[model samples]
Target: MTLKAGSILTGTIVNITNFGAFVEVDGKTGLVHISEVADSFVKDIHDHLKEKDKVKVKVLSVDDNGKISLSIKQAIDHKKSVKPIEIDWEKKNTQNAVNFEDKLSRFLKDSEEKFQDLKRHQDSRTRGYKKNTSH
Candidate 1:
């Protein structure tokens, strides 16, 4: 079968290397780069695929030298068939309120502790002043 550009093809993993996988489709063979193994980050290609595994790949480019560049990302359907994503504004507002309240409570507690320390210092100073004045 002629592997045309932009066409998705299914092939068996014949060989695997650190850089890419060699897939064979019918009599034709192509190289699927490690970057084209998945839509997300691929730390290791072995995590998603292995030799003798069947995988779907999309042909991205065909060089004049007959080199075929393939991508697994292109094989994914990114179009959302669902309705528009509506943010839960009310829930978000309530969550924000809860977060702000927690922060405010923490701040108030810190301020109260500082105020109490300051008041204690002032009272001590007042007592000292009274003793000095009396003496």
Candidate 2:
């Protein structure tokens, strides 16, 4: 298969280095830079990939010298975008309503308890002041 820019291809990790991993695809090898290995920061490439591991890579560019630039993260993102999101509308709506009601009731109960505590504190202070002034 001809490897072209933006094309996603499956390849084997032939070698791993401090800077990147070399992947072999269709008898040709391409470099997946450490930064292109994953979506997040890759402090160590070995943490995410191993030699002989199969990976999907999106071709970033093909140089005149046949050097190919690839990105695993972009390949994953492309796959994710191609999939359709599934949701049960009825189930989600009922669950959200129950959660909202539970949260609101808990908040109201806590507010009322705090208000009562403050009222009691104020009443006690008023009584103490009255006793002192009458003396």
Candidate 3:
């Protein structure tokens, strides 16, 4: 298959370095950068990949010099997109009905209490200032 940007391809990791991994796909070698290895932070490339390991990679770009940039994380994300998300509408609606009211009530109560406390503090300060000024 012709490799192009956004193409997902299975490749063998022929070499690994501190910066990235070299993957051989369709007889062409491409670089999968460290940041593209996984969704999470990669402190060490060796922890995520090894030489000769097969991995699915997404073509990010092919420069004029024939350098291809690949991403393993994008390839994995693309595969995940194939699966449909299942939602329990009944359960979700029930939970939202109950939880939203409770959460809103609690938030309102807390806000009111804070407002009252701030008002009381300001009032006391004002009264104290008036008394000093009068004397």
Candidate 4:
């Protein structure tokens, strides 16, 4: 089976590393990056995958050096099919209407004040140097 970009391929997990997993498919081995392993953060790769485990992965890219990039999350159909709940924004917050520009300006002023306060505290902590008598 010739591996191409966007192609779904079944392969065996040959090795696992801190960065990714090496999978062999159609006589060619590819890497599935940690981010591509699943839809969520993978603290430990061994928790999600193991050697000799058969996995269906989607080919993301075929680099010029012939390295194949794969994504197991993309291969699996995990899209939400349920309809989202629609919210009536205007009715929900009619009484508490606030201008975004005003809020942003206030936030910037607050941030600047806090930054100045921190700078002053830091400068005070530094020992005051005496002026040199010989110049």
Q: What are the TM-scores, per candidate, against the unseen true structure?
A: 0.57, 0.59, 0.61, 0.58
**What global local distance difference test value does model 2 have?**
0.91
How well is each residue in 6-42 modelled by candidate 2, as lDDT tens digits?
Answer: 9999999999999999999889999999999887899
Return the top candidate by lDDT: 3
Clashing pairs in 4: none
How far is 64's C-alpha from truth in model 4 (Å)? 1.8
- Tens-digit lDDT string for candidate 3 (1-135): 778999999999999999999999999999999999998999999999989999999999999999999999989865656687898766557777789999999999999999999999999889856445654
| Alpha carbon lDDT of each predicted model | 0.82, 0.91, 0.93, 0.90
lDDT rank, highest first? 3, 2, 4, 1
What's model 4's lDDT at 35? 95
TM-score of 1: 0.57
C-alpha displacement of 10 in model 4, angstroms?
0.7
Query: lDDT by residue for model 4 over 1-135, one digit each (tens)?
Result: 678899998999999999989999899999999999988899999999999999999999998999999999999865664367898866755444467667888999999999999999988977586657997
For model 2, state the Cα shift of residue 58 in Å.
0.5
Ten consecutive residues with minimal summed lDDT in candidate 4?
A: 92-101
Q: Which stretches of candidate 3 lie over 4 Å from their true place?
A: 78-135
Best candidate (score: TM-score): 3
